[model samples]
Target: MRLGALGTSSIAWRRTLPTAVRVPEVDLVALAGRSADKAERFAAHFGCAAESGFDALLERPDVEAVYISLPTALHHEWAAKAIRAGKHVLVEKPVGVDAREARELCALAEEHDVVLRENFMFLHHPQHSFVRDLLEKGRLGTLSSFHAAFCIPPLPADDIRYASDMGGGALLDVGVYPLRAAGLLLGPGVRVAGATLRTRATDGLDLSGQALLVSPSGVLAHIAFGFEHAYASTYTLWGDRARVTVDRAFTPPPAYEPVVLLEEQGHQERFTLPAADQLGACLASFAAAVRAGGTDSAREGADLRHDTVAAMELVEAVRREAVRVTVDQ
Candidate 1:
C-alpha cells in the first residue's frame, strides 16, 4: 500500500517514517506538513514527495493511507478527515482525548469503510508475547497483580505535551502506556479502582498520576506515570508461585535485546529475547490491513477500536478520581 505521512512530529521523523520506508508492504510516497519547506525536508529525508498540507496529501492518488503523528488534540479531527477522504489511518496513540471521540472516529471509519488504527507500537513487540507465553505456561502461578512504571525526565518548556489546548497531560501521555500494559497483562476488562492526578502550581496540566485497576477476573494492576522523574519503562507481574519482570518494556531500541527475569521462591531465571522492531511491525501490519481492503477480521482492527474506547474510559475515571493538591494560604 502507498502510504503518506501527515505530520512532522518527532516520532514520525525519528521512527514512523524511517520504519515505514523499510516495510516491504508500504511504499512511502508522500509527506504532508503545514509548510511546504518543512514537508520538503521530511520528504527528502525519506525519498518521498512533499505535499503542502494534509488536504493535498489526501488528494494525491498515490497515497492510499496516512500515518498521523499530530498532537493528541488534532488526532480526532485529522483522523476523521482522512477516513472520510477514503484513506486508511494509522494515528498515534490515544486516538482521541476521550472515549467518546474515539468511538466517533471508529464509527466514521466503519461508515467510510476504512481502517483506523492507533500506533501504540509497543503492542507489536515480541517481548510482550514472551511474557504472555510465560503466563500461559503457568510458569507464573495464579496471577495476583502487576505493577508498571513509565516515567521520563521533563521536557522543554515549549513542548506540546504541556499545552492544555493540545490535550497534554501525564495521564494521556505516558499513563496510557501503563494502562495498556495492564490490559495486556491482566485483561481487557480492567476497571479503574482508584486514581490520583497531580499538577504543578506553575501549570495546571497533570504532571504525574497513578491508577489502581482491577480486571473482571480479579487480577489487579498498579499503573504509574509521570514526566518529571528518572527514566524508567518497566513492569512486573506477581503470581502465586512466581513473579516475572521485564526491563525496557516500552521504547526499547529496535536492536536492543530485552531482559526478562522470573523468580520462583528464592531461585531466579533470566531470558534474553531476540531483537524486534515494533514500529516496523506496526507499519507492516497496518499496511497489510489496508492492502486487504480494511477487513475487520484480517486484523484485530475491531478489537483495537474497542480498546481505544476502553482505554479512555479508564483515563476518564482517573481524571474524575484526581485529587487536587493545594497549599494553605
Candidate 2:
C-alpha cells in the first residue's frame, strides 16, 4: 500500500483526491516533484517527510507503487521508469501520446510482472457502468449512434496542457473521454472516419475538435472536445427504441454514484446511487492487486493494449484528418 506520487500540481492531491487516498494510513510514503519547497509543502500537508525529486523518490525502497499525475508528456517516461523500478503504476489517461509508447510501457510492466493501471477513474466510476448496463440490457435497443462532448475553457498561459512538447491538445486531454465512452459502450475498435479541429490563438492546441468514430457494428459515434465554450460533461446514446444519456460523466464525481437517465417510448427514468469514493476505491484496488499478486481486472493485459491502441490510433486519425483538410484546401 506504499504509494509514491509524482506531479502534485494539476489535480491538487489535497483538493481533488479524497483524503482516504492520499493520507498516511494508505501508506503515502513519498512525494516527488521538481521543486523542493513544493514537495516539502505537499509532504507537510500530507504528514510525511520522505520527499525528494522524481529520480530520488524512485530510488526509495519503501515506494512499491507510483501514482503519476504529471503532465501528459511526462506520463509515459515516468510510468515506464516506475515499472522498471518494480513498482506498480497507476497512470493518468492517454497512457501515452501514441500507441507505440503505450505498448512499450505495457511490455515493460509485463516484463517485470508488475501491475500497470491507467487512472481512468471515470470508467472506475459507477455512472459509466450504469449507463453501459442500460445499453446492454436493451434499454437502448437497436443502438443507432452515440454522441458525447467534454469541454472546458482554456486555463492560464502557464498551463502544461497547452504545451505541444508535452503532447497537449484537446484530443489528448478532454477528447479521450467521449472516445473512451464510445469504446466502453460500443466495444473497442473505435476509429476516426473524419473530423475538424480548430485551435485557440494562445498555443494552437485544439480549442475545439469534432470527429466521428466508426464502430465496426455499423454504429456511428460522434464525439467532441474543446478548450472553449460552455463547460459540458455529458454523453447520449441514440437508439431506435430508446435513448440513454449521462451528465457529468468525466469528473468531480461525487463518489462512484453514477447518474443514469433512460428514455423510451416517451417514458423516462432517472437513477442515481451513492458513489463509491473512487480515488480511495482506485487506490484500494491497486493495493489489493499488488497483495493478490496481479492486476485486478482482465482488462489490464490485453484490453489495455487494445483500448489505448484504439485511442491513440484515433488521435492520430483526427490529427491527420485536420492535416488532410489543410492540404486539400
**Candidate whose lDDT is highest:** 1
Stretches of model 2 off by over 4 angstroms after superposition: 14-25, 200-203, 255-258, 295-300, 323-329
Error of 1 at 253 (Å): 0.6
Residue-by-residue lDDT tens digits, candidate 1, 16-98: 88888887888999998866788889998899998878898899988888999889999999999999899999999989899
Highest TM-score: which candidate?
Answer: 1
Residue 313 miss distance in model 1 (angstroms): 1.1
All candidates: TM-score: 0.96, 0.91
Residue 94 of model 1: what lDDT? 89
Residue 189 CA displacement from its true place in model 1, Å: 1.5
Model 1 steric clash pairs: none
Error of model 2, residue 151, in angstroms:
0.6
Looking at candidate 1, the ten consecutive residues that score lowest on lDDT are 320-329
lDDT of 1 at 134: 96
Give the per-residue lDDT digits (tens) of candidate 2, residues 1-329. 77788877657465433453454346777788767888787777776654658888888998888888888888898998888888888788879888778778877877888888777767767667777787788877798899999999767877888788888877898998888888888896777888898865645667678898788898988888987758998889999988888887777545445667888896988887676655566666667777777543455555765676677777778888863222110
